[model samples]
Target: WDFLESPGTDEVLYGGAKYGGKSWFLCVWSYLRACAFAKKHKIPKSSHPLKVGFLGRKVAKMFRETTLDTWFKTIPADGYVAKGNPTEIIIDDRVKILTGGFDNRELVNKFNSAEFAFFAVDQAEELTRDEMALLRLATFGRLVVNEKAIPGKGLLTANPRHCWLKDEFILNPIKQRKFVSALPTDNPYCTQKYIDNLIDSLKHRPKLLAAYRYGNWDVLEDAEQVIMDSWLESALNRHGEYWPFVKEYIAIDCARFGDDETVILLMNNTDIKEKIVMPYCRTTEISGRAAALSHQNNDCELVVESIGSDLGAGVVDELTELGHSVLVYTPQGKSSEPDKYYNCRAEAWSKTAKVLCSGVIDEDSNCFVALTKRGEGDNYGLDDTMRGQLCTPHYKWVRGKIVIEPKEDIKDKLGRSPDHADAYVIAVWAWPFISMPNKSGSVRHRKRQKSPMSM
Candidate 1:
């Protein structure tokens, strides 16, 4: 009722969990609004409706098979018809509803030229912030009623994910937006058998149950997630907090070519100064550039990961020859505690997770660690990709020892390498091992350096 009755809010999110009638709500609401406009204006029967409303998910096929199916089943069949290759529904000779997905480049391009009176995206979490912004922009100045433009109103429905939607609507909401929680229990039509199955399936995973059944956005991670969502949030909240440190370091995850990205993070203790990302670059080129950056930043120790590839080893050699102290992080090496972990990599990741969760978890009260962005200027130092990657990989027990999933598995799951998270872990892993003295007794300020590629 808030979504349909509230005209002040330009954007409204309806549901957060499955079986909440989210798709049905969006479809029925949009269709009714379009029909209302048609009835009020007495729009003449024509081929063009003068404006279009959009309804979609990430992929058109899935949208058609699922959400579109719901639309067909719920709406009145009379005077309503779906046409075209993908599908566009025309209702009562006035309202036109265009349906497509972000994955369909052609359909998305068509949306670029179209103006919408109403729009709704089901399973909107699949789309990025930019895509959502584009959808909002398409509705601007186009929602005309009685020949006067009204505030652009739209609906979004999604399950909880650590994405922009959660950050924008759930975490911090603007005045023009409203978020309505819709759980399976809220739907009277949802059968007991279905709910029982959902409960039974997710009983072993409490976090998943919290998100899927109860609509809890706070706990989004499962049991195997190395970094919990709360831990990452705590780390992000620690930004701008004061903590003194003298030692500085640079951690690099190198990628020479292809779709993989190279990430270099500069830090003073656990506080990060900058994150440099570059693509399609040589190992030597980036290493040399980082070495120069290290020199520029008071000759901080350079840490490079050299596991499963000689690229990092080559970088170490290059930096060493350039008269810079370098540390090679071979994650495949034996862990310091041989019985606790399958390898050093697993140990490092576990330690990094512990570090991020330090004050919040407090498993070790004496072990206080804070990984934050430097200064009060930047609120969030860690980017979205980095945090998501950090929380992506799961852990397993192998022969009574903890072992992290292979990089290949994570890469496949993420559809790209977990480069940013790996770089962060490498930096955290090298933190205690380096015992260099503070030259100036405090972190000296130099004009922040940016690499040519970085700039």
Candidate 2:
């Protein structure tokens, strides 16, 4: 009711978990508003109909089956009539209410050229940021009723999901926009039996239950996350423990886009000794190569570079010419264990999880450790950012093989590339561990294996 009463607000989002009156509210509110606008400005007898409002969903078929049904159930029968090619509701003889699908380019193009007094979308989380922008563009300076102008308005309804809607409506909304949180319990008509059924169905899936039943926007996805928050928290400040070391590895993840940062890490055995990030600029490639060279030690066994840009390849070529061995780590390339993993990136991240939790390094019983700064203010450095990034990339099984989420989707959720986590995983996967000398000054060489099924 507050949303309908407030004329100053240009856009509003009514979102939450399932069984919320989102669909009912959007359909009924838009219908009533269209009718009210028509009643205020009665047109001439022979005049053409005016497009008063629009309603949409992700797909046309789904819109017809879901939101269209809700609109039909809640509207009056006498004055309004459904007509047109794709079916629009005509109210009070001359006002038209249109419907379109966000995924249908043809319908979207047609609506893009038309104007409306208001527009509403149900299940709006399925639409991309670009599609939403285009929907908003259609209403600019185009709202008119009987040749008189009025303020254009928009309303969106969605269930909890990790998308731009969460960022725009929940995290950092603009002044012109208002957010109204809705839950199943918010609707007095919602039945207790439906709530119990939802709880029973999602009990095994904790993340989904939190998102669908509780409207937790922070729960990223339903798939298994690669790194848990508890694992990262447990491994903090573990570099002080004593561990034997004979091999050194360096990993570099180059900046692929304008806003991305180039990340470099130096690891001695299972201990992460150093990490640094520099913003991308004209001298980033040159500075990155120099940074990689500066971290090299006499005991450095191998250097791995994950390249997604020409700048990254340039660093590899320059290092190869300087008598240093460098391996190109392709994220989409075939994994060494093809039967188990979908790609090298997935394999690397899975191994890193084992190292973080409890994986034996050489004869030592220590796991991977990272050093922390002693002071107070922002002492976590790239480690803190890496922890947040690490917790986002989820994995799922496809045809009996594990496949990690795509890099673009992770970037969408994080608002930046997971460069620091990428570098750390590369160091863990490509590290060449050599056994330390025994008590009798005898060296024993063995292939590194945590287990047959482990890293």
Candidate 3:
């Protein structure tokens, strides 16, 4: 209340653990306040109804399934007109409850044009920052009551999520924002059985258990998420198939040393008409030189190949002797972009992060809508093991620069080496240079045209 009632417009984030009745609070509080504004203003039924906008399908469901029962069973119906048309209610002709969602443009447009005494945002963390901004704009100058102005207020409820909510409210507390981390323990109505069910269902997903069950807002996915789980899930669920093409390179992380299996990721990046496609991935104990020979025998492009540094240097030298081009991944080698990273490995991870975070490709169509030409989206073969590996590494901040978790540390957490992940990250690093006309580094000193995968 202090934050909302203070002297300026504000948003209050009621966030943290799951099943804390946070959404319930946002709904009732906004409605009750709207009622107060209407009654105080002596507003007539024909006058512009005082309203409080509710955002998200979940909130609408809550109001319909549970909240409606509370209002009718507890509060007298004579006090207000309660009608359910996909969930809208009125109390004493004073307050109008408006609900909408990202999928409903009509609801969004209504909010855009109308004024509200306040707004209620449910599962706000699921909304992008831009969507929330639009809601705030809708509240502008609409908070007048009783011939006086009150600051436009927004109450947002959310489960634990690593999104703008975490950044604005907790990581870097924005001015005038009241961010609360509410736990199940803090709510008397939140039952132990409910909490126990969540714990049981999420026992295998540690990240979720930390956020939803424990409400550890300061932790969870914030941990070194080198590559966030969201990105991996999105990528895995986004695309299904790809066709092999020219402008290909094979990157292999050799398992010559131990229990690790060597991984070969065959990628296609030949045309600017399409984002890169990684269609073929293989795991084997085959020697590096033997793998090269196999591609050679098949009359494959076999243009560029890279080997992990952990494996013996023999295969790289042998491939060179056989007149095949092979690049060796050097973790401490100079970075392509030194400003953000210390070395090639770190830069590769940075590149992977960039592609994942930026919505360069359409989710359903798997098309590269970000490009002016509008081509197919970059794709990777779906392998659950590879997906798990892709999300395994945690990032570290070294001298203010980002770097991947050390092999030792990653192995400790994963109980196995991230060979497939290294193979993929190194493959991304190899794309710009590997496809360079036969002479890989001859044009290195000269500026080259951007790879289709970039930007």
Please report how far candidate 2 places residue 44 from its true position, in Å: 4.2
Candidate order, TM-score descending: 1, 2, 3
Superposition TM-score, candidate 2 onto the true structure: 0.50
TM per model? 0.51, 0.50, 0.47
16-68 in candidate 2: lDDT tens per residue?
77767888999888888887777777753334578878899887766887788
What CA root-mean-square deviation does each model show from the true structure? 13.5, 12.2, 18.6
Q: Which ten contiguous residues of candidate 1 have the minimum total lDDT?
A: 359-368
Q: Enumerate residue pairs that collide in model 2.
A: none
Question: Candidate 1 lDDT, tens digit per residue, 292-342?
Answer: 788888888889888655677788888988888888888899998776677
| lDDT of candidate 3 over 1-455, digit per residue (tens) | 56666665377888777666675676567657667766667777854455654534433433454445544555456766655555566766656776545556667667667666677776676478887777777775666666676556788877676778888888887686878777777777766666655555344356656776567775665544666767655543433334221235666666644566556556544112211222222222234444554465342223232434434355566555655666677766787656457577777876665565553332343322111112233233534555577787765423224556567667887887777677667665665565433423211111123457753
- Candidate 3 regions exceeding 4 Å error are 52-78, 84-86, 143-148, 220-455
lDDT of each: 0.74, 0.68, 0.57
Question: How many steric clashes between backbone atoms does each model show?
Answer: 0, 0, 0
Give the winner by lDDT: 1
Q: Is candidate 1 or candidate 2 better by lDDT?
A: 1
